[model samples]
Target: MSNDEDWYQRYLDMQNEYDYENTTDASYVQSKPVQLCSKESLNNFGATIIPVFYYVNFLLSYLGNGLVLFIIYKYEELKSVTNIFLLNLVLSNILFASSLPFWATYHMSEWIFGLALCKIVSSAYFIGFYSSILFLTLMTFDRYLAVVHAVAAAKSRKRAYAIIASMVVWCISIIASIKELVLKNVSENQFSGLMCDESGYPDSTMARWRLVTYYQQFLLFFLLPLFMVMYCYISITIRILSTRMKEKCRAIKLIFVIIFTFFACWTPYNIVILLRAIQISNPGEGVSMCSEEESLDYALYMTRNIAYLYCCISPVFYTFVGKKFQSHFRRLMAKNIPCLKRHVSLNSQSTRTTSQKTPHSTYEY
Candidate 1:
């Protein structure tokens, strides 16, 4: 009996030794350091490229939109609802363009403007972005009314109505951007020094805030407005096609251009924003993959730059395309610029002659 007891004790000791060895090996594997993903190359690329593009955009947007404002103020009586909407659109573009320089500086260096300026700049930027989209939607609706429901539009599209609509759009834009005003501040980054971004919260809280804002922009600014603009343009196209108006083909072409431009400018940015929102929501799969996150960062930057070009292009599409505006601009320049007087007079005479030949043709809007 004593010999059997001793053998059993030895077997139990061997089992314990095996279990301890397995535990020690498992902990050793778990304790190894994780390799962190570095974004230094991406940051350097952005610092090199973003400032240049932003400065160019700022210059072009201000010049184009400012010229539109000057032409409209000098010539238009502000009675046309379309002109009123165009004024608001140009103003929105200017407001948006005003923030580009600050952002350019931010990209080149740290946010040296402090927390107050950061909030103001961020809020203004978002307000201008939101207002510009809203105004475009309103303008499309105005066109839809003019083409699809001409008689009713003639009755309802008054200067008062346009003023009220402008006010409402501005209010909505401010409200939508209130988040930026509330949340934006200068946060310290170890690699980048100070950054003007959302902070003062836990990582989880910041992620949630970002997710909410991204979806808000995606849904309200991009998706909803896109649907509205598409519907308006489609209705306008169908109405123009069914009619026998002499300018129907020209009108259809303009509608196609507007829709195409809108999609080309905004779709990629919004799609990337939606992806970012999804990645934020699904941390286990999306956040764990550093390669995917870095790719998304690159995508977001490129797409946003594409979207920024619209501020410069909007003036050409909305204002300069109109013959009336061109005439006004020529006359304004001729009056102010001595060298162009002779050319302007000749062009004016030629335009008048062309107008006389086509009495039924209206100014392109």
Candidate 2:
């Protein structure tokens, strides 16, 4: 029995030694280093936590943006130049939010849909993202003209001209997005898994073009517009404070709140991306260009998640704040107090009759 036990122990020791030798072989040691940002790992992250959060965010943003669009479209009162710009903004955001599901799905797994979807999905993202920024910038400019140069703006804001300008903005957005559609391609990574991304630009020319495009995006979309928004709001704020016209003050306050809300939702993402662009020389990394590009990627990913939260909830803010809500509350009051409606109707009729009777005759003759 003792001899048998010693023989078994020696056999176990021999097996362990052989296993260690095989593991340390040169061939085994030369095996490929595992990629940290591989499809499998990214998918794991995307599938488990990231997708669910973004999906909920996307749903909220879609509903809010869609509601805003419907309000602008359904009500003639909400179809003014101000509301028209907002309609376009909401439309762009809706389109942008719609792409989140595809992205979330992609993050969960490899590009299973195919090549065509990759192009269409990615192009929609670019179109919506670019157009959103452009429209917001246009809105700010429109506000600037309306408030700072009211006479000029009024003269130029003819219905036909406004329609044409809106068309032109759409046209430009389409043109700008064409490159993105063409540049993106689907290819397999080192691990034999497929990925739908901008790939196969081996030359410096394509690399440079991508880099330039990213910088352009940052400058045109974020930096320039952000500066303009800041300037317009600051000037407008000063004007409101200086004049202290209590009647117009509420409207000015609404605009300020809207601008602040925009900044609160987007500034972190923009700043993080800008830092990333500064760090990376490549166009693909985007906001991942910071010194700690990998860490930045993770941070941008997290920040984007946070941005979506803010953006998705922004509509709720819009619904509750400022003149929109105040008017709604007043309507509720009118509903509860039917007598107030009768008085308002009577006053409106009286004013209309007086205007019809007097008009140009009382003013000129």
Candidate 3:
């Protein structure tokens, strides 16, 4: 019995030695000088969080912007220049929200939709984004003209001019988004199955294209519009402070909200985009590169989600903040909901009396 136990122990030792040798040989054969960064955790986090927020944003933007559109159509005829701009802005929000479901599904899973939809959806998304910024900038300019250069702008701020301006903005947005339609397609990702993204170009060409796209968005869509909005609002503020406008307080409050919301939501995303462009231009080596990329990925994800929320809040800034819109909305609710009719009527009467007292107020809309 002792001899048999000794033989079994010898066999176990020999087997362990063989296994260790094989593992060492395998490791030597497969060893890499530099380890690749894994983004599995980031992808998982995005798949879990992004879809939910996107769906919520879609719902809120659709509801708010849709209600604004309905109120505008029902109560306020598109006669005034402001009303025309407002209509285009609401349309832009709806257009932007319309693409959210596709993106949400894309984030949740892979891009099951085909190549054609990939192109169309991508183009629509960018066009909507650019158009929204343009419309908001145009609105600010319109307000500035109405408030700062009232007499000078009266002749030019016609409905015809507004329509023409909206058309021109749409053309610019579409032109800006042409690359999405041209370059985006359904491609296979090794880790994530298929995705809808830019493809079909040489590596160098694709890299250049991406850099151009980032700068285009950062400069044309974000920075330019931001500067324009800031200039207009600052001018408006100065004019209001210098004058004795009855609605100066409300104007100031609206301007603050607009600037604050725009800056808070978009600045981070633009900064992340600019950083990504710089990183791509000059990529670092090894573990540090991996870490920097991971950080940027996380930042882009978070800041993009924040930026998307702007559409959801746009209706509040553009329409709900206006007393005229409030009166119209209340009247609209009163028309639909019989229970609130009496209360709304009384409120409308009070609003009308106040408006009559201040008949020449240009800031009502």
RMSD of candidate 2 to true structure, Å: 11.0
| Each prediction's RMSD to truth | 5.0, 11.0, 8.8
Ranking by lDDT: 3, 1, 2
lDDT of 3 by residue, 1-365 (tens): 59999999999999999888887895756765666899898989889998998898899888888898888878889899988988898888788888999998998899998999999989888888889889989988998899889999998989899999999999999999999988898889888999898888888988999999999989998999999999998898888778766767877888887889899999999999999999999988889999999999999988987887896668657888877988988988898999999999999899888778764577664
List ranges where model 1 is wrong by over 4 Å. Answer: 1-35, 284-288, 337-339, 350-363
How well is each residue in 227-286 modelled by candidate 2, as lDDT tens digits?
Answer: 888898677666555653544455566767777777776777777777666655643332
lDDT of 2 at 245: 51
Ranking by TM-score: 3, 1, 2
**Candidate 3 lDDT trough over 10 residues, lowest sum:** 26-35
Among the numbered candidates, top TM-score falls to 3
lDDT of each: 0.85, 0.67, 0.88
Comparing 2 and 3 by lDDT, which wins? 3
TM-score of each: 0.86, 0.70, 0.88
Model 1 per-residue lDDT tens digits across residues 75-126: 7778889889998998888888899999999988889998899999998898
How high is the lDDT of residue 185 in model 1? 78
lDDT of 1 at 93: 85
What residue pairs clash in candidate 2, if any at all?
Answer: 273-287, 276-287, 276-289, 276-290, 279-289, 280-289
